[model samples]
Target: MFLTHGMNESGELVSVADVKSGHTNLHCPFCSEKLIARKGAIKEHHFAHAGETCMESKSTIQQTGLPFYDIATGIGKSDIKLLDKFQRYDNVWLSQKQAETAMYLTQGGLLEPSPNKPEKYQLTRLGRDLVKHHDSLLQKKIILPEATLQEQLFPARLAMLQYHDEMNGTQAARFYQLRLQALLNQHLYVLKIHLQQGSTCFPLIKVGITSRSELALRISEIKRDLQQHGEVLSIEIAGLYRHFGSLERLIHKRFRASQFVIGSHTEYFHAIETAHDLSLLNLEALGKRTVEGAYCRTTYREHAHKVRVGQRKAKLLNNTHLGRPAKNAENLLTDHPDIVEAFHASLSLRKANTKTGKAINTVRKVYAALKESGNT
Candidate 1:
C-alpha cells in the first residue's frame, strides 16, 4: 500500500519506518492529510493527526458520496466476490487488474480529470450520482445472447460487459446488445484472419474503452478501424472472467485521489478491491500501439484481461524515477534492508517460474551482500 518510492529493487514498494518523514505517505482516506501518526492505539487505524506538528483533519465520508473502503467492502462481501457465490468460472481468483476493469466499466461519464495531474483519474459528478442510485443499476439478471464464436469468445465478452454496464437504462442496454447482434448478423464467418506469407511476422495493437451506445453507433466505425489495420481475428470475448460483476465494481472503485477506471486490463477484479493500478507497460510507447509498418502484416486481436502483467509494472514504476541500485550488494544490504525483504518475498512466491527465479536469486545475492556489509 505504501512504497518508500525510490527503490534498490525496481517495481518494489519498500515500506519505510517513517512514511511521513519520507514525504510519501498516502493521505488518510478520511482526513485529506498524510498525517496518520502511529500512536500504537486501537480504533485508530487512521485517526486525525493529533501530534503538535499534526495538520487538522476530518473524516471524508459524506451522506451522498461513497468512501473507498465502503466500495471495497461492498464488492468483496457481495455474492459475486472473487469467485461467484454459487461458484462460477473454475473457482478463479480475481487478480487486482480484473477488479479494476469492473470498477471503471460501471461508471457513468468516466471520473473527473484533475488539472494538477490530468493523467491521474478520479470520480466524476455523474459517476457519483450513479453510485447514489445503485438500486436502479442492480435491477438486471440477464446476460445478453451471442450469435457467433467471436461473440462467445472471452475477451470480447468482457469488453461487451464493460460496454453494457455503461448503458444508463434498459433501453440503452438493449440497444447496445443489439450492436453485437448486428455485428454478427452483418459479417459472414463472424471474424476472419489469414496468415500472411512472409518472413518477418510481428503484430501491434491499440485498445480503448467505449460505451455500448458508442459501440452501437460506431459499429461501422470500429469495423473500419479493424479493417484498416488487418484481420480482426478476435474482437472476441477475452476477459469474460470478471464481466459478471463489473457494474458493482465500477460504481465502487476509487483510484488516484478519488478517481475510478484506472486499470486497462480486461479482468482486473482484484485491482478494483484494493485499487492497485500497478501494470506492465511498454517502455517506449506508453499505450498499446504497433508501428505503421510492423515486421509484416498485423492482426488486431483484442482480449480483455483484468491486469497488465510483467512490463506494465516496470513501466508504471519507471515514472517514479526511483534511483539506481546500490553500488554493490554489500552497499545495498548495509543501506536498504526493506528492499532486501521485498526481493526475498518476490522470489518465494510460487508465482515465479525458472526465468524470474534466476533474476530473484540474483537480487537475493545483493541482499546477502548487504547483510554481510551490515555484519562487518
Candidate 2:
C-alpha cells in the first residue's frame, strides 16, 4: 500500500509533494521501512515502501491521542460551516444552532471570543491553520483507505509539528528566545537623529545594542537625553536586528573613523561620511552575506550617489557642511564657497538650520563677516 506521509531522519512527517520521484531518505511512519517517492505524470504522488509492506501499514487501528484526527472526526457539518463563516468574516455573531456547535468547538480549542467584542466569536490559531490547509487535509483523506481514517487525519498534526520545528530553527525564532548565552543575545538598532551643535544641525547615526524588550521606551529615554543637545527633530529607526550584537560591533568598527562623541555617548557617526555603511545594512537586511554580486555593487553606487546629491542640496539650502565641521572662517569660505554664497544670497538662517548634514557655525560666521565687510 502507498502512503501519503513518510518520516524523515529528523522524525518529522513529510508529504510526497516535498520530494522528487526517486528513492528518498524517508521511512514509513507506520513500519519504519525505507520508502520510494512515486510522482508519475498520470497517477497521484505518494510514497511506497522499498521492501514488502508491514502488517501495520495494511491494517487500520483506532488511533487515540491525535489532535488532528479527533478534531476532524468530532466536528459536524454545522461546526465546519461556522468555522468557514468565521474565516470569511473578521468577527461573527453565530446563530443559535451555529452557537451550539461553536460552543463545542470553543471547548475543543478551535474558537475563541473576539478581542474587540466579547459577544462575537473568532477562529483560534488552530482553527486558522485547519482552514488554511483544508484542501491539503482533504487530499490526504482521499488517498488513504476508508478504514484508516486515523492514519489519514493524523498527518495534519504531524505536518504542523514539523512546521513548528522548522520555524524554531530560523534566525527570527532564535531572536525571540531569551537565552543565557552571551552571543546573539541582544537587539542591534541603528538610530538616526539630528544633533544641533551651536548654529549647525547635522544628522548623527547611532549604532548600539540593547537587551530591553520595550524598544519604544528605550527610544524615549534616548530622546530625553539628546533633547538637551538638539531639538530632537526626528528619531528614526534606520535598521533593526534582533540578537545581533556582533553585527553592531562590526558596523561600529567599519565606521570608527567617522565616530564622534556627544556628551557621554560615543557610538555616534557622521551620516554623510559613513553613507557607504548603508549598503552593508541593506545587504544584511536582505540576508545577503557577500557584496560581490552586481546587485550589491549597484546598491553601493546608488547610496553613494544619494549621499553626494544630499550633500549638495544640504549646502545649497542650509549652508550645511558635508564631511566635517570647519574650524575657521578662512577654511569654511575657501573650501565651500557655494555655502557662503547661499547664505549671502539672502537664504534664511532659520531655513538653513532646518537641514541636517555637517557643521554650519563656521559658515554662518564667515557669511556674517563677509556681509559686514561688504565682500558679498
Candidate 3:
C-alpha cells in the first residue's frame, strides 16, 4: 500500500514523494524510525520502516476491532458480553477508538442499546437479517470430493490442463506456474474515484491500487483528501485482480504524462471525460487483456494514449520555459511520438535482469547531446 502521509524530521505530515534522500529525513508515523521511501517506477511510491517493526499494523487492528464483522453479528447481547466475545478472539485490551466504534454502530441502528442497563444492547431487525444472510452464505456446501495429496500438490497443473485443452506439455506447465503465482498473490485491487456532480469546477478522476486489508480506511483517507478540493459524492471499487502489481505498473506507465500530482504525490491520472468514459474503467475492461501486454491489447489504450498526449501537449504549451522556442533547440525532441513511446516501452522492460537501464541511459545521452549542440 502507498503511504499517503509520513512524518518528516520537522514532525509534519508529508507525502513520501516529497522526502528527499539526504535533506528530507522522514519517519514512519507508527515506528518513528527513518522511513524507506520506495520510488520504484514499476511499483507505487510507499514509505516503510527500514528494519524496525511498525506498530501501525497491530494498532490499527486494535483500534478498529473488526467493526465490520462485529456489526454484522446479531447483537442480542450486552456490551459486556460483546466485548468479552470480541476479546476472546481478538485481543485482551480494546482501544478507546474501538469503544467509540461500537457506540457509532448503535447510532447507525446496527445495535439497539437498552434504556435500563445502558450498557446492554440488542441487534436491530435489519442487523439480524444481515447476520442470517451471512450465515446462510457460510453454510453453503461444495459438492466436490476432498482432494488427494497428489492432486492438491498439482492442482494448478490440473486446472491448467482442464482449462486449456490445446496446451502442449511445456505450455501447460508454464500456464500452471503463472496461475499458481496469481493464486498465491491474491487481492490486488485497482480502485477509482470520480468527483460528485456540481461539487467542483471540473470533475476529477483518481486511480490507485492497494494490496492491504484496511481498504475502508484507505477509501476514507482518499475521500478526505478529495473533499478538501471538492465535495465527493461517491467512491467506487473499480476492479479487483490477482497478480495485479504488473497490471498497475502498466497502467501508470501508460498514463505517465496524464498523472495528476496532488500534494506532490503522484498516483492519479486525470481522466478528463464524461461519465461514460469513466464507466469504461470496470473489472471486465481491466481483466480483458493479457496481464503482461502493453497498450495494444488493452481496452482503454486508445483513450489513455489520447489523454496522455493531450496532457503533455497542454503542459508543454503552458510552461513558458518548456514551451520557449529556440531555432536549434532539440529539447522538444524528447516529446516526439517515437521517443515518448520508446521511453514508456523502456519503463515496461525495467523488470528483473534487463538492459533497460542502458537503453534509457542511451536515450538520455542523445537528448543531452542535442541540447548541448543547440547551446553551442
Q: Candidate 1: misplaced stretches above 4 Å?
A: 1-357, 365-376
TM-score of each: 0.17, 0.29, 0.28
Q: Which pairs of residues have clashing backbones in candidate 3?
A: none
User: What does the lDDT read for residue 112 in candidate 2?
Assistant: 84
Task: Please give, for residues 74-151, the per-residue lDDT of candidate 1 as tens digits.
Answer: 222231232221122323344576445444433323243445665434444433333333334452222111111112
Q: lDDT tens string, model 2, 40-86?
A: 64454678889997666554212112323213432344556678798
Global lDDT of each candidate:
0.30, 0.57, 0.45
Question: Against the true structure, whose lDDT is highest?
Answer: 2
Query: Using TM-score as the measure, which candidate wins?
Result: 2
In the order shown, the candidates' Cα RMSDs to the true structure are: 28.2, 23.2, 27.5
Q: Mind giving the per-residue lDDT tens digits that candidate 3 earns over 1-376?
A: 3443456666555655345433236766556777677665465566666776566534432222211211222222344354344323433344685565455445545456656655655555544444444345442221111111111223322332333333232233333333333322334454556665363443445555444544687688788877776677677775555333323333444456677666544666665642344353343423332234111122342465676677678878885333334433354454443543444454332331143334554455444554466632
Worst 10 residues of 1 by lDDT: 184-193
lDDT of 3 at 161: 39
Error of 2 at 306 (Å): 30
Name the candidate, 1 or 2, with the larger TM-score value. 2
Q: Tell me the number of clashing residue pairs for each predicted model.
A: 44, 1, 0
Model 2: weakest 10-residue lDDT segment is: 289-298
- Give me the overall lDDT of model 2: 0.57
